[model samples]
Target: MALPENYDYFTREQWRNFHGKNQLNTVTGDELAQIAALNDRISLTDVQEIYVPLRHLIHVYLRRYHQLVEDKADFRGETVAPTPFLIGISGSVAVGKSTTARLLQLLLSRSLPNQKVQLITTDGFLYPNAELNRRGIMARKGFPESYDMEHLLTFLDQVKSYQPGIKVPRYSHQVYDVLPDSYDVIDRPDILIVEGINVLQLPTNQQIYVSDYFDFSIYVDAKAALVEEWYLQRFGVLLDTALQDPLNYYYPYAIGDRQAAFTMARQVWQDVNLKNLREYILPTRNRADLILHKTEHHVIDKIGLRKY
Candidate 1:
């Protein structure tokens, strides 16, 4: 596939050089293990080469955002309100967006020790499995229509308005459903990182997009085939972990014939994930402020910074 025309792409080596002299080495091996997603690989070297420079860039953006807010407040003769800098991270399934979000959250928190940095996934905004089944779209679970975009938009609006104690619905991968009556509270944060496959999507019939609230947005990119391989690898890991818990969503597949399980996984990957990626996710790649392009084994080999 051809790269987008709107970005100035760089090799990982070149991208590593972009980090100024003020890079901090706060993340250790133990921390990386906790931050990484299942079956995801991220070395400290990768952190120093890729993420550190990215952190510096975010610092630059955050500084400018604060200045803009202060200038606007001065011009209007009003006090500057607590508006959190919002960062959106989007990618196809198994592309390691959660890892990126968590790592950035840690980096930003350490760098700005006095500021409160929070990370939330759009999985929480997904409609319950019961609702999807009732709507007869269970097969299209990850599709745009399966999500409650209105609720997500409302939450983003509230966060941007500096609303305190806002509740976000919780979703669980163990049961593959939105937990009933469970929520995560968002108390006024200084920086918020929202990560999900749908973060950059433009839903039909909606006047406003989720991206509209993002001060900085990233899209994780990889070839569909590579993503499929990673997805299946992750499935294997899930099966191994789920075997100990009967209530796990993959319990049945875990206890079933291994070959048959992989066969079904491939089918689902092609029908559901690949379809969603080609139609919805990939189209939004150019919409992000930056793109992290990955190669084999989840290695981020290239970085694409938007020209505008």
Candidate 2:
């Protein structure tokens, strides 16, 4: 594939050389197991080559960001503390974005020992299933309109302004809904990673976009067909786990004919996920500061760094 304008694209071999060796020693095998998403694979070598370089770049951004913060404070003639540096990670469903987000969070936390780092998903900002059903858009759950963008924007505003103890609604994959009365408290952190498919989306209804608060952003890229395969593979794993749990949202499908269950999964990938990716998510790809392009089996083959 041809590279986009304003981006310096590099093959994995070339990108790996940007960061020196021996960085993989920090991430252990057990940590890799914890960070990897279901049906997603990531090795320590990937960390040393791809993520380590990525982390190094983030540090470069952070240093510049801190200098600007001090410069702005000096212009106002008042000493001001630094606000949270927000990183937004976005991509299509089943594209291993969650894995990337979690991995980056861990890496940043370890490297920036003095700075506090926190990670949250925009899934928490999604409208409850009941609300979606009432709105007659339950079938289009992952669509841009299904999110409570106003609420999300408000939360991001608070975080960027250094608000403490802000609560984020909790979302449950097992129930496939936003859990009522459950929340995660985000104390003001030095750095925040917001990950979701809609992170980089521009909702027409909102005056400002979610990406407006981001100091840096990354978009995970992969072919639609490859994503579909990974989606189905993940669905199968979900079914296997749901088989023993009656409360699982997938329990009904897990108990039914396996072939029919897979058929439904494929249909969802085509009618919902694929449609959202093509129309909304992919269109925002060029807006990212960085892009990680993946090949077969979730291997990142190339990296794109925006020049401007």
Model 1 CA deviation exceeding 4 Å by range: none
Off-target runs (Cα >4 Å) in candidate 2 are 1-3, 20-24
Q: lDDT for each of the candidates?
A: 0.94, 0.92
Tens digit of per-residue lDDT, candidate 1, span 117-201: 9989999988898899999999999999999999999999999999999999998998899999999998999999999999998
Q: For model 1, how many clashes?
A: 0
User: Model 1: which residue pairs collide?
Assistant: none
Q: Give the CA lDDT, 0 to 100, for residue 214 in model 1.
A: 100
- Model 2 score (lDDT): 0.92
lDDT of 2 by residue, 1-308 (tens): 24468799999999998864545547888999999999998998899999998998999999999999999999999897859999999999999999999999999998988999999999998999999999999999989999999899989999988999999999999999999999998899999999999988887677687888999999999999999999999999999999999999999999999999999999999999999999999988888999999999999999999999
TM-score leader: 1
- Residue 155 error, candidate 2, Å: 0.3
- The lDDT leader among the candidates is 1
